[model samples]
Target: MNAPLLEVQQVSRSFGDVRALDGVSLTIAENEFFALLGPSGCGKTTLLRSIAGFEHPDGGAVLLGGSDLLALPPNKRPVNLMFQSYALFPHLSVAANIGYGLKREKLPKAEIAQRVDEVLETVGLTAMAKRRPAQLSGGQRQRVALARAIVKRPRLLLLDEPLSALDRKVRAEMQLELKRLQHEVGITFVVVTHDQEEAMSMADRIAVLAGGRVQQVATPLELYRNPANLFVADFIGTSNLLPGPSAGQHLVVRPEDVRLVAPGAGRLDGTVADTQFQGGTSTVAVDVPGQAKPFLVTEHGATEAVRGTPVGLAWQHEVAVGEGLA
Candidate 1:
């Protein structure tokens, strides 16, 4: 709708013989929180870098707000990148770091100070304005980095694994903070991350990439519940991949969807191979006859079966079947 705020058309990149990105294309609407998610080396970072003008694509165009970004330098484009490392000037105070971009633009001192103060308050770091990077905690440092990026009032913000360095609890807090900041500022945020949970919890839409190609793009729930292909189903979360003939090919089903019934109650019988207790949930591995690998079943109820117990396994036909890939 409204002509996407950012359009990436047939983007491709290569280094020597290795193709890092292959004919990838996507559109990001204004004020959308878009995430590029995949395993390491899947080209998510390359795509973000291409948008930020750090990496030039071998083929394709990156357009921002209908303007060709390829024709401009990184600074010339209305984009700011908040690097993963925080990239704070350790030597500069919090205010100084936040005002770094404004200083480079040669804005008047009063204006730079006013904008810096506003952003510091917006990120809730006004109390630590005099502190340097070394004086702040991990979360504070992250906010400083964010304030620095948003101070320039760019049309788009690029984040490259911005929360990967923080501890789990702090990372979770920052996720909500980032979302709130985005809503308050109303700027488009495109983040590149390999952490599935991070992307699932934060993004409005996720683009799953594999081997330099985009596998699927959808809302978090849509991607999780109705994956387009096998790679996406396995990557987004824990699942049981059962190998069976379907239209002369293989099919998969989720572990939670597979039910364990009394022996002789279902079509298949399996011996309980192992059990793992994870607080409130349990995962039971069942070894079925004629199958090389065990089938994993995740149940929320307390453990009822012990190892070596014979059980019947069944799944709804709809859950057991996945669309066959070509």
Candidate 2:
């Protein structure tokens, strides 16, 4: 949204017969927490590696501040990449792990120590500075990896599935922490993740990729509410695709948008085939006639409806997202 900090223009890459990236372009603002979100083999990682200069693209340009980033060697680039693996040296202390990059740079030891101390405090790991990677929990280990990456004060940081190692609860907590650290560190973060919720909850903006191409780029709310096409609608969240009023089009409705009504009272009636209680809310799947998949509707609190109960699906408005947007 602001002046572009990183510009990827018409980038294309191929691994033998497979086109890993095809004409992918994006502009990321400075200090923005951007996410490259897609399923496996979608080329998000390839694009990231291209930006980091680890995997050179077959064509096109990667620019940082309007200069060619692909010109620089990987070690010479002013960017850091944190792999999914923590990559902390088992024998090294947390402080040492964070300071290793500075050590490689041949900076004065005192400066490295001061920076490490400051980062340790910022990441809330000052108390565990002396602990080895083996001694830390999964979350703490992830913090150590992040600390190591950021200690260099790189212009940008690339994370590859940074939360994949943690359990669900810790993953949620670290998502908050990662966003906090991104703001405090003031470094542009570009994370690659297949988990849609992780991207939606943590990123400032998301770029959804499929078949090695970008499907859409927007804020999480925009992507959920106004998906550019069918792939995005199905990928970003669950959707009920009812045949549209016009041919070759469909009306999209989310579970939260659909209302459950008495049999034959609304637009479509069906049998309640399944009910799922997920804590505060419940999901009721109705098997509508002429529909291959069950239509899902959300009900607040708990669902008391039993299987085989007759129900109807209702919604106030019908929208065709766009003509041939798919």
TM-score of each: 0.92, 0.97
lDDT of 1 at 325: 35
RMSD, candidate 2, Å: 1.3
List of clashing residue pairs for candidate 2:
none
- The TM-score of candidate 2 is 0.97
Each prediction's Cα lDDT score?
A: 0.89, 0.92
Q: Give the Å shift of residue 170 in candidate 1.
A: 1.6
Q: Which stretches of candidate 2 lie over 4 Å from their true place?
A: 318-325
In angstroms, the error of model 1 at 270 is 2.1
For model 1, which pairs clash? none
Off by over 4 Å in 1: 1-3, 244-248
**How do the residues 205-254 of candidate 1 rate in per-residue lDDT, one tens digit apiece?**
99999999999999998887788888887798776665545654446677
> Mind giving the per-residue lDDT tens digits that candidate 2 earns over 1-326?
77789999999999999999999999999999999999999999999999998899999999998999999999998899999998899999999999999999899999999999999999999999999999999999999999999999999999999999999999999999999999999999999999999999999999999988999999999998889887898888788887766677777788887888888778899999999999999999999889999999888989887899998788767443433434
